[model samples]
Every structure is written in C-alpha cells, then in structure tokens.
Target chain A: MAKVKHHNIPLDQIIKPENIVFKRTKLFTDNVLSYCPGCGHGVAHRLILEVLEEMGIADKTIGIAPVGCSVLAYEFMDIDMQEAAHGRAPALATGIKRTNPDKFVFAYQGDGDLAAIGTAETIHTANRGENITVIFINNGIYGMTGGQMAPTTIYGMKTSTTPYGRDPKQMGHPLKITEIVAQLPGTCYVTRQAVHTPALVRKAKKAIRKAFEYQKQNKGLSFVEIVSNCNSGWKMTPVQAVKWLEENMLPYYPLGDLKDIGLD
Target chain B: MIVGAIVVDTERCKGCELCTQACPFGIISMSEDVNSKGYHYAYLADPYACTGCENCALVCPDTVITVYRMKVEEPSKAKN
Candidate 1:
C-alpha cells in the first residue's frame, strides 16, 4: 500500500519520468499549506504558481500577498514574495513593478482586502494602467477575521456580522468589483473563474496563465477574479459548501471573461 | 491497456472528501479510520478501476494525492 506496491512492476517501468502521471509541482515548497481544509486558497495558490513556473518566470516574478489566509503565501510559493498592508497589495505591487520593470509582478488579494479597504488603491492602479496583474479571490465572506460579511458578500448571505442575513436596504448590494475594474481604461484583460471542481480548476488556471502572458507582453492591468468556496467560514461541510456555491454563488457571480482589450 | 494507481499521504490529508467527488471513476472513497490529523483520509477503493484521469490530484487542496499511470500496448490475439 505504500511505495512498495510497485514491487511486482519492473524497476525501469516504475522509475521512468515518462511514466509519471502526476506529481506535486516543484514551484511549491515542501511546506504544508496553512489554509483550512477545503479552503479554495490552496488551489488558487497552486494554480498561479504552476502557471508562473510553466512560463519560466518563477525566478524573475515577484508576488505581493495581502493580509488574510494568503498572508503566508510567501511560505509555500518558492519565489520571492512581499507582504503588503491590509488592502494595499496593489500599491506595493505598483512600486515594485516601477522599480523592477523587468520582473513580472502580481498582487493576490481577497474580496475584503481588494474591494473594501483597498478599493481606492485597486481602482487607481488599474485606472493608471499599471503593467501588472492582480488575482482576486471572492469567497463572499471574510475568511480570515472569523467569517464576517465582506464587500462581495451576497445580498442575503449570512455571516458573523450579518447574523440575520445581509440586508440590501442597509448593506446596499454585493460589490461587483471585477465588473467595475473591467471598465477601467487600463485593464487589458479581466476574467472571473472558479476552482471547486476539476474542470473549473483547469479553466481558472488557463485564465491565470493568460493574465501572466499579457503581463509578460507588457500589457496594462490584467485582473483575474476567482470565485472560491469557503467551507470553514460558511459553517458547512466541504461537500455542502461546494454544492451551495454551485447553487447560490454562481447565479450572482457568474464565470467567464468580463473584458479583454488585447495588448494595447 | 492503462495501469493506474494513487498513493495517499495519510498524515497530511485533511480528509475533506474533495478527491472523492473529483474521481470520475468513483473508485476513491473516504477511509473509515481517522489519521494523525483526526480526519478520514481518502483511499483508492478499486485500484483497477482507476482511469488515471488525474482529476483527484487537480482538485486536491492538500496536494496529498499522487497519481501514477503506465500504458501498455494490447497483445495480439495470436499471442493471447
């Protein structure tokens, strides 16, 4: 049941690299992910790192991780990483990119980080047409601060803050930051994807890759929004969280590219 | 003929059942016993039925599953 299970198979057959079907990407360190079980941050981290490795930009790429479950992203991703103040990953990325124009810079931020406290920075960076990429994870609720309502929380979604459910009259409406960012003149590509299922993971990875490719070509502001499941924060089992997301979240934050202006 | 298999890292597995749902062949299931992490880790219930599609690995948040596959040409009827 262990590595010894291959005892009957020929040594050469089992040891060959070509016969290897799947293995952990080397871009990720041996460090175990700190994200909660069934948390989508792990998948999002892996997909983005895989793309950076595949594109051979791992050595030169720089990452700005916002405060949240992803704050320790520097621990897992083997590349150089910098932690930014809450909701200011975009501003830090702007400075880093300006100084090191040759490096591929990307900022990874959560819904609360990007759409709320960092809203001004997020908008201004994209509006100014910074040659950088931003990865947004919209899980509807604040995952790091004990499941509170976030800027992207659904209209009727329940959270620590919204115990009786989010009231549209008082809370206004769920922020569609991806759509807002897409309308910015500097944004060259904008897409919203998910990672709850295997098929969806592939699509999300492709979108991240496209954003990186645009960055490599000096495209202005490629933003990718990933709709992820927060089973822990949502107070549901892993299976139930995914099912709920497919049922409730999809209708509100649908997938697919919101805009693409090509290389300009 | 394709031979497929997966080795589970029981210690690191959080047993979230993501791999169970990702298995297209339905050969993966949760183990009744708990691991060091107090989670029921996933196991390959029917190894022979595995298509080596790598779906489980892709959706695995823990990265605790590794898939291996080997393809062999079918022997001719005369040899059979």
Candidate 2:
C-alpha cells in the first residue's frame, strides 16, 4: 500500500500565543517625516526603533545625531539625543559613553560624516574599542547638502559634486567602511545591511540588534552600516531608489557580518 | 481560545495602502476614515480569515501594523 505524505507546519505556528514577543518596539513619535517618498532613511530609522524596543533599552539609550540629512534623527528617536558637529558624532558619542558608562550610547551618521570629514573620529573610536554602537547610513551622496559627492560615492555615479559622474581618475574609488572597521582589533561586531525590501529589512534589524547586544555586553565597539538610498538626491522615485540601491549599491557593499568578535 | 486582535499604530502608518493591497485573504480593507493623525488607515473587516502571515505587517513602510495570532486549543478527546 502506498503511504500518504503530510507536510509539517512550523512549530512557531503551533506554539502558545503568549510566547510571541515583539522583535522591536514602537516608541518612535507619530510625527509625519520630512523625508522624500522613497528614501531608505525612514526605514532605517524604524529598524533602529525596533531594535531599541526589543532590547528594552529606550530609556537608557543616548543617540548622537550627525550633521548631514539625518541630523534631525533626534526628532524621530524618542531616546535622549545630542547634536554633533559635522562629522563629529563619533567623537560626541565617545565622550558620552566614556562619561556615562551605564548608558547605551550610539552615533547615527551618514556617508559624508563617516567616510569623509569624520573619518579620523570614526576610525579612532573603533580602534579604542569604545563601548558604543555606530549606525552608519551610506546613501552615496550628501543628501541634505544638495546631493554633493560623498567619499563613498560610486564610480560613474553622478552627484552635485560629480555632475558628469564620479570618475575614478579624478574622484578616486569608493570607500568600504565595514571592511575598514572590521580590520580594527577593538571592534566587536560589524555588519552591513540594507532596507530595500522586507527580507532585507529583517536582516538589517537583526544586525542592528546584534550591534546593541554587543554594547549591552560591554563588548567594545559595534558598527552597523546600512546601504541606504537617497531618493531625492539620487533623482529617483521611492521605488526607483530601492531598485537602484539593489542594482548599483549592493554589488559594492555586500551585506552580512564582516566581523563578529566576542559574540556568543 | 481567542488570542489577540491585530493592532495598528496609525501614527507611524504612512498610508501607502500596501497593507490593504497585500492582504492575501481579503480580510483587510482601507478605511474611508482617517486616524487621529489624519492619515488613511487600513482596517480588518473579517478577522476570521486572517491567517496571520504578517504579509501586511511586513510590507508596511511605517511599521505600523501588527498581527496577533490567538491561541486556540482543540477539545480534549478524553474530556469530551
């Protein structure tokens, strides 16, 4: 006699309802954002909020806002925030964490802030193994300052500073920060993520949470670089920005944990 | 046993209408009415058909919607 085969459903589906825990929190204020329709910063912001919520550390969290487009991150995040000078969020966060050892300190910076003017601060912060989380948003251009060329600007990509497109000969190559930070011994957890889609967003959140977890464990420096999209700066619609990020950015900045030292 | 109903934090909702469109079981419908924040909100007219796949929750740009699957126990054979 032939046997019938039955597919088994996931155990999670059969578990108790109370066992379900929110992966993140919803502490973000209900203000309508000023971001462009398809900008990935909004998604990145929500993911950070979720991570803070899941870790139950909103009250203990302190964020350092960068000078670029994301300078206003303090407005969205409900946690205590301090405004840093251009490319100085890492320095500010370093001081905050050093003084307040019990607080969870993080710096939210853009490509221009991380890869350019703030390069020394970011590198030294990671090198010193500061007990802080650095969330870097790489949109490849200076979104707030009118789409100027960022240090991470892709080759052949056009921006205000590179109207004819970024030429390697004159503009030099794009910088890969995750790889750079991964080389430092003081760095504990380093990962790159994107927010172009749901699956990717989920992965990004996991990385963000892991970064925070590292900080919670006092595991030195944790860095999460999000390959974001600047729809308004890139001159693309929201959908187009996502598509462009996938097509153009992912190839250069592949996603995943570049370094996971001391993580259990 | 009924578990919990899905709740939407309308303040974070962007009114993209993707949640309403992504509902596979036709249980979610966009409300003509807006929320306290004034953005259009998605409503669930038929909670029974919701499979709790979280498809709507996953697609929301604002992370506003949440699907809560209630635990339902089958009748105990010996007790019955």
Candidate 3:
C-alpha cells in the first residue's frame, strides 16, 4: 500500500538541521554496495569504516581486500585499498603495515579466503604478531563461488558442494580459525561478533574500534571475526537466513572475546 | 510534540525489511509501491512514534536511512 503523505507538512520543515541525530559518513563512497539484499557484508563494511572515521584515521588508513565477495570493497570504502590475490590479504597487509608503520592497516577477508585458501598466511600474520587489524567475515560458505562448502562451514549444513549436508567424517570438522589465532601469543586482541540486530551491531562496532585503538598503540595482531549470513547462498530469504543463523550458526560459533591482551 | 524523524533514500533501499524489524516502536513499514529498482522501500508508518533511538538506521544494511532527533526547548522567561 502507498504510504500516506505526512500530515501535509514538508519533510524539510519536519526535519531541521539541529535535529539530525545520524547521517551517512563521508568515509563511504556514493557507490551502492554490491552485496546481496540483507547481506551482513554491508553492515560489517559500514562498522569498519565507521570505526575508522570515528577514530579520525580514515585518511591514514589502508584496507586490504580479499578475493571473495568483498574483493571490490575498495570501491565502496573511500580510503586507500589494495587488492590481494586469493586469501593473501593478511600477507599483503603485513607488508603494507611494516613499511608504513604510521598507517592503520587492516585486511578484510571472508571465511573461505581466510580459513581455506589463505590459512598459512592468516596463521603466520597472527603468529608474527603483525601490528595490523584483520576483519574476518564468516558466512559459513563461499558466497561468491556459488555456495560451495567452506572450511568454516558447520556440520550438517547443506551447500552446493555438499548437497546431502556437510559430513564431518569426510569433510573434517568445521575450522575454528578465530580460536586458533587466539591461542597464539602474538595476537593482542581477538573477538567474535555479529550484526543481525542493533545491540549486536553496537557491540561489533565497539570491538572494531578497540581493534583500531590497539593498532594505534602498536599492539600485536588484532583479529575480529564477524559471523554473518548468506541468504542467496543458503537458498533462503533474507529474514529466514538471519533466523537460521541465530538458530544454527551461533551455537557452533559462539560470539565473544577469545583473547585480549588489553591496551597498556 | 514529535521528538524524532527519519529520511529513507528510497532508490538505494533494497527492501530487506531489517529496519522494520529493528525498529523497537514498530513505526517503520514497507511501501506498497516499488522504487526505481523495483524494490519496495521502507517508510515511517507512524512518524510521531519515533524515539530517535537510531535502531533502524543501525540495522539497515543499505545505509539509506538517516535519523533525526528534536531538541527540547525550555520555556522562555520573557513569557512570564
């Protein structure tokens, strides 16, 4: 049904300049996001950029884009961004951070790019404690590749590669990559979060801001894993997929801090 | 008096409805008509009910919604 015109009052008259509470930040370009409708990637991207903008480091920050759905993240993020080969964002971020020590360097990668193809690079970056941030978006499957099973895909989840569902005996157990990195001494802060709701989104932003703050202090590696939803890949509507994630994904990949060395 | 309002960029919205669900006051709802992109956009169904909590803007994946809060004015002493 068509929305009724508001009380015959002009919008400008109703919404004044001083009454503005929130507006889009300039840190993001005008380009529309390429993510699917209701995809968590958009929220994750916004949170990261918002954190950078709030910290006043948008001009001095460099983002490394992975080879997955967000490979073109550089286009949307109005900051210096470099495209890395498949699963090589962490490695690229390490080189960038080491040379430009003053810049805030971060690698944005998906579960397939981080936990699968680039496992070695991901591990070593955290092991060496590279003074950088890693933003991992785990949607459980390879979203850009037609919904194939990913290393982080939970058990019994159906994917294009596993039509009958993921069999742990044949596919091996789902990888807890965030937990794996938290065990390493090099990681200064590591947390898992989501953005399905407002409260969760706020907490996720806090974690991201903390990650950047740690980066400013020259703290070791900081990793933030965001468990997200892939509606198109999972063959569900946006709403259904999010509900499924809450019911199925959260239990296997619980959200919380795994490691925090604290800011000195 | 109304304390809050929101502006939705109709063309940019994907009609995901997350904002509708996220609005604690249930003021936002999907439009019957579609935008230029053929997607139904969200609008404030009950504008006066908005509390400026920003919950809808925070959950909107497209980032098309902007929230505004009104400033409460004190009574003028000159009137006395």
Overall lDDT per candidate, in order of appearance: 0.88, 0.78, 0.90
Give every collision pair in model 3: A1-B32
Give TM-scores for every candidate, taking all chains together and pairing residue i with residue i: 0.94, 0.79, 0.94
Residue-level lDDT of model 3, residues B34-63, one tens digit each, is 999899999999875566679989988879
Give the range of the ten consecutive residues with the poorest summed lDDT in model 2 chain B: B70-79
Model 3 misses residue A115 by how many Å? 0.3
Across B2-30, the per-residue lDDT of candidate 1 in tens digits comes to: 66678788988898999888887777899
Indicate whether candidate 1 or candidate 3 has the larger DockQ: 1
The lDDT leader among the candidates is 3
What is the per-residue lDDT of model 3 for residues A131-248, given as tens digits with 9 covering 90 to 100? 9999999999999989999999999999999999999999999999999999998899999999999999999999999999999999899999999999999999888888999999
Q: Residue B72: error of model 1 in Å? A: 1.6
- Descending-DockQ candidate ranking: 1, 3, 2
Q: Over the stretch A120-220, how does candidate 2's per-residue lDDT look in tens digits?
A: 99999999999999999999999998999999999999999999999999989999977999999989999998876667777888899889999999999
lDDT of 1 by residue, A72-151 (tens): 99999999999999999999999999999999999999999999999999999999889999999999998888999999
Worst 10 residues of 2 chain A by lDDT: A1-10
Give the Å error, residue B31, model 2. 9.8
The alpha-carbon root-mean-square deviation between model 2 and the true structure, to one decimal in Å, is 6.1
Which 10 consecutive residues of model 3 chain A have the lowest summed lDDT?
A1-10
**Candidate 1 segments exceeding 4 Å error:** A1-17, B75-79
